[model samples]
Target: MTAPIPRDIPDLPAIPGIPVLLPSHVPATAVVPPVRRPLVATYRLLVALIAAAAVSLELALGSPLRTLSHFAIQSNILLAVVLTLSARRAWTARRPLPSALTGATLLYVIVTGLTYHALLANEASPYMLPGVLTGEAAGPTGWHVITTQVLHTATPIAALLDWLLLTAPGQLHLRPAATWMLYPLTYLAFTLVRGELLVPGTPARYLYPFLDVARHGYRSILANALLIGLTSYALAILLVALDHARPNPLRHRLHHRAKTGFRLQPPVG
Candidate 1:
C-alpha cells in the first residue's frame, strides 16, 4: 500500500494542460480534505507570542505622547516587513527580484557613508573608521567620499535573502522559520564589528532608541540586543507566513506565459 499524502500540501489548482499523477494508480487530484497538523499549531502559537512581544517593546518606550514617534518607527518596520515579505513571495514564486530593492539598499549605504564622511571630515571617532575604510578620497579638500565597506556589509544580506528565496527551489521546506533570523544576526554582526550599530555622530540617534541605549550600560545594551534578536526572529516567521499566503503579480504573469507554451530561455552565451 502507498503512503497517504500529507495534508498541508494544498490541492493543486485546476490549471489546464497540467497532468496529476499518483502512486498505486490513484488520482493525485483526488480531493483529500485538509487536516490540522501539530506543526501548524506550533507555528501559530509562536507567531502570536512574537506579535505580543513586539507590541510590548514598542509600548514600553514609556510615553503615550510618543505615539507619533512610535508609529513612525513601527511604520518603517512594517514597510520593511512588507518589502521583505513581498521579496520573499516573489523569490519563492520564482520571480526575479525587482532591481529596485538592490538599488535602494545600495543607495542607502552610499548616502549613509557620505553623511558619515561629511559629519566627521576631520573629527576622529570610531564611526569615522568605516567612512575611511569604504570611502575614496574626494578631491584635495575631501569634498566627497565613497564608502564601499558599508556596501559590502549590507549587500551580502540582500544577496543572501535573494538566494534563499529566489534561487533556491524547495529550500524553504527545511529553513522556513530560521530564514527570518538573518535580520538580527546581520545586525549583531554589524554591531560587533563597528562597536556601535547604525548611524554615529548623527542627529537621528534621538529617534532610534536601541542605538541610543548602547552607551547607557552594558547590561542595558545586552537586554536591548536580546530583545532585538527575539523580536526579529518572530517578525521573520510572520513575514514568511504572510509571503506564503500572498500571491505575486509577476508569478501570475509567469503562470500565464507557461500555460501558453512559452518557454523562457537564457541567451546563448
Candidate 2:
C-alpha cells in the first residue's frame, strides 16, 4: 500500500493545475520608497540649461554646421539631454537612469574638457572654423568666451559634482567602460569620413588638429587616433575604479542614523 500523504501538505503533483502558495509565516520582501531629491534636481536642471544655452550660442554665433561637427558641442548636447531627464527623474522620485548611460555621458564630457584644455586651448586661436566664419582671429571674446568656458569648464565640473555628491556609488562596472569607447570610436570614423568628403582647402574640413588627415596624413592620423583611443579607454577604466571606490554620499545620513539609532523628532510649536 502507498504511504498516506500528509493532510497539511497539498499534493502539488496531483494538483497540477492548482497554484502552490507560500506559507503565511513567510514575509514578502519590502518595497523601498523612492527618494525625492529636489536639490539634486534643481542643480541638474540648471546645469542642463547652461549646457544647452552654450551650445545654442555657439551655433548662433558661429557656422552652425561646423559648430555642430565639433566633439565638444556634441558631447555637451548629450550632457544637456541626459541631465534634463535626470533632473526630472530626481524631482519625481523616479528610478535614476541606468549606470552605464550616466557613466558614459560623464566620460564623454570629461574627455571633451580634457582634450580642449590639453590640446586645443593652447592653440593661438582654437576655434575650429576660420576667422571668416567665427570672426575670432584675434581669439574668442564676449559671448564666445562665455560659451567656451561653460561648455568645456563649467559643464564638466558640474557633472562631476552631480555624480560625486548626489548619486549613489558602486553602480558602474568595468565592462561598460569598454563599451563607452564606442561613441569616441564612431566620432573618429565620422571625422575621417567628413574630412575626406570636404575639399582640401575647405576651412575646418578637419575639425580637430589631431584628426586632420590632410595635414597629418592617414598614417599619422591613425597613430594619433590610436593613442587618444587608448588614453580614453584608460580614463574610462579609471572612472569605473573611482566610482567603485567612492562612498555613497547620498546615503550617508541614513547610514549614520541607522548606525547610531538616531531618530528625528518634530519641533515643538
Candidate 3:
C-alpha cells in the first residue's frame, strides 16, 4: 500500500508458468441435404399402376369377394398402395417407409409369384373356371393372360428391382423376418375356416390343392402347411442375408467423390 505503482512498466520476459490461449480450430465437414428423386418416383408409380391394373382386372372378371380373398391379389393390393405412397415420398424427399412394412410387402409379393409358378401355373387353380386349363373350355384370351403375367411375373420383378436398385441396403433384420411368417400362418387358418364354412361341392371350396381339406384331410393339409411354412422361413432368412451382403448402391458415388477430394454436390431432382 505504501509503494507507488510505476507509470510505465518495462517489457517483461516470458513467464514459464503462464499459459497462452488461442482460438480452437475445427475441421469442416460437407453436409448433404435430402434430394428429390424423380426417376425413382416415376418408376415406382409405374409399378404401382401395373399392380393396381392387374388387381382391378381380376376383380372385374371374377367374383369380387372371391378374388379379393386370394393371397396373390391381397399381396398385389398391398404392393400397389405401398408403392404409390413410396413414390410420393421419393418425389418430395420425405423419409422412406419403415423397413418392416416395405420388407414384408416385398416378401409377400415374391411369395405370390413363386407360389403361382410353382404350384398353380401348369396345374389347374381352384380359382380358375372348370375346363379352362384343359382347353375344353374357352380359356382366358388377351387381357386375362396379360393380367396373370402382370400379377405373377412382371410386378414381382419390378418390386425386387426397386428394392435392390433404389433402396439402401442392410435395413432388414432377422427379427422382422421371423415375424413375417405370421401373416401366412394367419392366412392358413383363414383358409381352413373358410373351407369348413362352405357347403359340400361348392366351387373352389378349398382354394389351393395343398390346402384341399376334403381331399387331403386335416392330417395331410397340416403336413403340407408345415412344409410350406418351413420353406417360407428359409426364404426369409436368405433374403435377410442377401440384404446385408449387398453393396450400398445409393451412396457409392458420393463416397467416391468424397475420397477423391472433390466437392460433393447434392443430387438434383
Candidate 4:
C-alpha cells in the first residue's frame, strides 16, 4: 500500500552502498581546497598568538596610551591585528587579504625588526627603550627579552614564512612596492610634526634615533630616511620576484594528492 519512490532519485545498489536518501551533490574539491594546508593553519595560529602576546605585555605593564606611543609596539599591534584577521580568513576558507595590504604589513614588521637589531639592540643607543630588548634583570627583564623576541624576531619571521609557504604565488606586483614605502614615510612625517607639537617637558618622541632632528641634523636624518625607503622598495621587489617563482602551497598539495592516488569524488549534480 506504500507509494512508489520518486523518479528523480537514483536507486541504491542492493549490495548496501551509500544511502540514496542523502544528497551528495557537492564536489570533493569544493569541500577541500588545497590552499587550506594544515601547516599554514598552524603557522598563522602561532603568529597570531605570539603577536598578540607581545602587544598584550605592553598593555599589561603600564598605561595603554603610553605603550602604544612607541612605533615598534604600535607596529607590532598592527601586525597582530592583521595576522588575527588573516588567520580567520584562512581558517574559514575565505579569500585572503589583498597582496598589497599583506605586503605592507610584512614590510612594516621587517623594518621594525631590522631597525631594532641594526640600530638599537646590540649596544647602548639613545633610541633604545628601557625594559625592551634587554636581558639583565632577573624577573622583569626576562619578560622584556621575551617580548622583544616576539615583536622583532618571531613576528617578522612568521610573517615571511606565511607569505612564502602558505599563501598562493604571483599576486604581488612591482608598483605595490612604491605604495608600500608610503606608510613608513607617512609615519616618519607624523613623528616629526608630533615632536614639534609636544611641550618642552616630557621626552621628545622622535620614535627612532635616526628621526631625531636635534641629535642627528635634518640632513643626516633625511639621508637615513631615504635609504630606508630605498631598502623597502628593494625588499618589495624581492617579494614580487618570490611570488613570480610560483611557490604555491595549494599546487604542491594538489600534486601530492594526485601522486598518492587520492582523487576527489565526482559530484552527482
The candidate that achieves the highest TM-score relative to the unseen native structure: 2
Q: What is the lDDT of residue 91 in candidate 1?
A: 32
Q: lDDT values of the candidates?
A: 0.37, 0.78, 0.79, 0.69
* Model 1 spans with C-alpha error above 4 angstroms: 1-176, 179-183, 189-193, 196-209, 212-214, 248-269
The clash number for model 3 is: 0
Per-candidate total of colliding backbone pairs = 2, 0, 0, 0
In model 2, which regions exceed 4 Å deviation? 1-31, 123-138, 255-269
**Candidate 4 — which residues are off by over 4 angstroms?**
1-39, 124-140, 256-269
- TM-score order of candidates, top first: 2, 3, 4, 1
* Angstrom error at residue 70, model 3: 0.5
For residues 37-76, could you state the per-residue lDDT of candidate 2 as single tens digits? 7888899999999999999999998889889888889999
The local lDDT score (0 to 100) that residue 62 gets in candidate 1 is: 38
Candidate 2 positional error at 232, Å: 0.7
Residue range 139-187, candidate 3, lDDT tens digits: 4576677887788889999999999899878888999888999999999
**Model 1, 1-269: lDDT tens per residue?**
99998879978779989787655654432222222223323432333344334334444533433322322223223334434544444333333334334333323333333333433333453223332221222322121121132122332344334333333222122253554345445654544445344466643333323334544555776675677556545544544454445444233323333233223331100
Backbone clash pairs for candidate 1 read: 134-148, 135-146
Q: Could you tell me every candidate's TM-score relative to the true structure?
A: 0.31, 0.80, 0.78, 0.73
**True-vs-predicted CA distance for residue 172, candidate 3, Å:** 0.4
Question: How high a TM-score does candidate 4 get?
Answer: 0.73
lDDT of 1 at 15: 93
